[model samples]
Target: MSTAAANEADAGGHELRDLVTGLGRAFGGALVFSLPMLMTMEMWELGFAMERWRLLLLLASSLPMLMFLSHYSGFEATWGWKDDLRDVAIAYGIALLSSTILLFVLGVIGPGMRAPELVGKIVIHAIPAALGALLGRSQFGQSDEEEEEEREQSYGSELGIMAAGSLYLGLNVAPTEEMILIAFRMTDWQSLALIALSLLLMHGFVFASEFKGSEATPDTPWWSAFLRFTTVGYAIALAISCYVLWTFGRFDGLSFSTALGVLVVLGFPAAIGAAAARLIL
Candidate 1:
């Protein structure tokens, strides 16, 4: 067999190699994604200019992260980034299209969207989903049967990671019970817990939806329908945020454009960070 296949087979035996490699990919992916989120928030909230050159520089830096994860110790990619990317492309396409239709039908979105802004939003958001799915697929390759099994095995890991990453990400914006009172208009510990609880519910909604019917076969869709629902719903929330521009529009100034670049550009890092943080850490 080819060297690639040999490594794939070997990874099954060498768990440490796979774990280490996955760790690299996941952290790399998270860094790529998180940077944009951090930058955008800082820019919008703090009134810093999101320099185009800075974005470019960040992109250039992300390639190495992708390559590193792509070439880590036990990462036996059956198909290169192309295949995972292809998966991402399909998933995001379906998501964006459906979400767009839903928005138009619901009348939740219009007026503020110029053609240019619409296209920009598409490129920005779609790229991150593509990267998230791609890196995740590459870092954690499994057949339909395997993906299902992984889903089951992933339960504990998922719960833990959600606690960390969600808390980490939310702290910057929502401020968990540990430190939320100073931020938004929320109350005490209960409110913070509820927010995290909602995301967990969202994740369960996504996983359960994917874990059903014929689609739940070994080829369980990467961008599962429920996953799409969560994303599209999130996107719609952002749209409503635009509408809220007239109301509590402070966050309208908060941006995620920076996080998008890091995330879309590097696939495995963010996914792995999430997985590792949840499971191992």
Candidate 2:
């Protein structure tokens, strides 16, 4: 075959593969994501968490990332690492925004609801996303399960609904003071945790679905991938913390509480990614 024809054939092969992966991801999420809900309702006996319920409503609400990521990962794997990283950034970014939006909507719709408390629950719950990101990242450079894990290791902003809540709480009453005080509130452990858990769950589920693929790859061993993901994420987080401290850290305006609060809020996704890497990857 001519060189030109050979290249074309290789390129064609890649496109076909990505199409398969994308379909696999979308269809997989569609099939499985809702499984958790039924188990959740049965487990907790709670109603669906959404604007309204319809058959598969919550799953319908959720699972785009599943389709997106499966296709995303499959495409990336078939295509290149750069694409995979881009997918991760986009997926996580959307996740962060969505969770923040939901918190506000819930706060507004449920008058009796304690908004701050709701935020906290979200962070804790999102532990999964952290798992997934790391899980996904770990796959980037890894070895297959054939090698035993010789080692072990571990480890967004803003919706006005939050602003309105702050006002209701007290900050909103005034405007300038409210903004600053509300910034502090954003750092709260509760708010921080909720964001963390919420992001974690979304990503975690996606990563877990892909876990099998990573392990099957000769380079990607399960435990090592998890440990590596945690280390890398923590390293990045630390560097960011330092930058924040150097820039905003000194001012009394930015206290430990604020820092911790921000970390928890932002770190929530990291936690989820790391966990997913560790557990699922």
Clashes of 1: 20
Predicted model with the maximum TM-score: 1
> Candidate 2, residues 5-37: lDDT per residue as tens digits?
999999999779755554344333322322232
Error of 1 at 73 (Å): 18
Q: TM-scores of the models, in the given order?
A: 0.30, 0.26
Poorest stretch of ten by lDDT in candidate 1: 261-270
- Residues 1-281 of candidate 1 have per-residue lDDT tens digits of 99999998888767776556544554444334333433343322221222334334433433433333332211234245674444334434533454344334544336776654444333332323323432453344544543443323233333333333332233233211222122344344544454344445454544544443222333656566435433433333333222222121233343364222222212122222332333322
> CA lDDT of 155 in candidate 1?
39
Best by lDDT: 1
lDDT (0 to 1) per candidate: 0.36, 0.35
Worst 10 residues of 2 by lDDT: 156-165
Give per-model CA RMSD: 15.8, 15.8
